[model samples]
Target: MAMMRNITIGQYIPGESVIHRLDPRTKIIATFLYIVLLFLVNTFSGYACSALLILLAVALSRLPIKYILRGIRPLAFIIILTLSLHFFMTEGHVIFQVGFLKVTQEGVVRGLMMVSRLVLLVVGTSILTLTTSPILLTDGIESLLKPLKGLGVPAHELAMMMTIALRFIPTLIEETEKIMKAQMARGADFESGNIFQRAKSLIPILIPLFINAFRRADDLAVAMEARGYRGGEGRTRFRVLRFTYKDVVALIFVAVFVVVVSIYF
Candidate 1:
């Protein structure tokens, strides 16, 4: 059987650690900078430094190591595929050959490096989302994009939409699972069927799912209007976000990590 779809972007866990307490804006900026720095890193030393920083962050967040690794389990196959392609396709003095396919020392090195980069990229960003709440992330995004309001952009509206979408992902997933189970109970065998049969079986689940989704959209619209929701006009937040000393310290640490990694590269 296929594994259940537990892996998602916003797998947040509430906590009171230093990393958890930093403003969401700081985490967003730091994650962006970290990704940029990952590309700048080319040498083993650079990778080592980046790995150390990720580990430090993971430890500080106080989340279980297994949970973090589990989040990346879904990406394992993609990482393997990437490594395989890089290993077999790149041209060099062949270390080994299988018919027309050749493998080289450079290919091996490049493949390993590519896999490592992808793993680090996923795990590091997972840390950001794992610690910060989706609401905080959306709020930070709106605050950061506020300057665009001068250009007639609807920053708050966009952020609100994103927040709602993020909020509903798990709910939708659960709904889908329930629909699938209900169909299964009615002898809708999705697993032991031909392609056409499987497609036909899904129709029952899809129809109800779509109808429910539309109903949810309509209800949300009505609720928003009932609450006097306007498009970012003189809106005030219930929880006013403020940057604290932890944010400053996290930025400083991030800057140092970038500098050290750059030097290593």
Candidate 2:
């Protein structure tokens, strides 16, 4: 599907804007704080502030609005499912009624809140992945989780796995596209089926996809081992990460934003 190529949630775009220039650790921490605040928000005013923050970040990233927003498309089904549940199950003064089912004023408000929360959450995280490179993201995560290494946690290993997973998203999508084209060449009918039939048609695609994925994983492991790779013990990075003045400013902004949203918004 052409729509599959448009998915950019886990892909990084190369840019020189302030957002892309900031240290990955700063972006990661700020995103975590923003998500925390999003969960705390219960009012439209709070969501307004949140929207402003995400918009500001998007503007600074110097990325096309469409590219950033396209990441939300793949999530449309989940968003609709969540909104439907809240709209139907929440109870208040009935706004509309059909048979035994009622749409209430409270349901409408709650559904709106859930929609805003989900949108903000997805957009905020997408910004993180969009600006930061996979390598930097891994380093940032490993550094942050360095504290947990004291408790027998495999911090570096976990970070490596997470980084590989994120890095594989675009690769897997591209692979799927190739497989689809190959199947289409072989008279596979992926587009002419109903819901269940369409899903059934995907069996041919899925079989090769899973096989290719396993093959790639094995190849990656072999390559790593060939390079004398072992555990993360005493691993040295060529690019040493440091906190710059921009990182300090970003942290201050997050702190102020969190305080304002928590107490005032």
Candidate 1 has an lDDT of: 0.87
Candidate 2, residue 61: Cα displacement in angstroms equals 1.1
lDDT of each: 0.87, 0.90
lDDT of 2 by residue, 201-261 (tens): 9999899999999999999999999998897998888978899999999889987997789
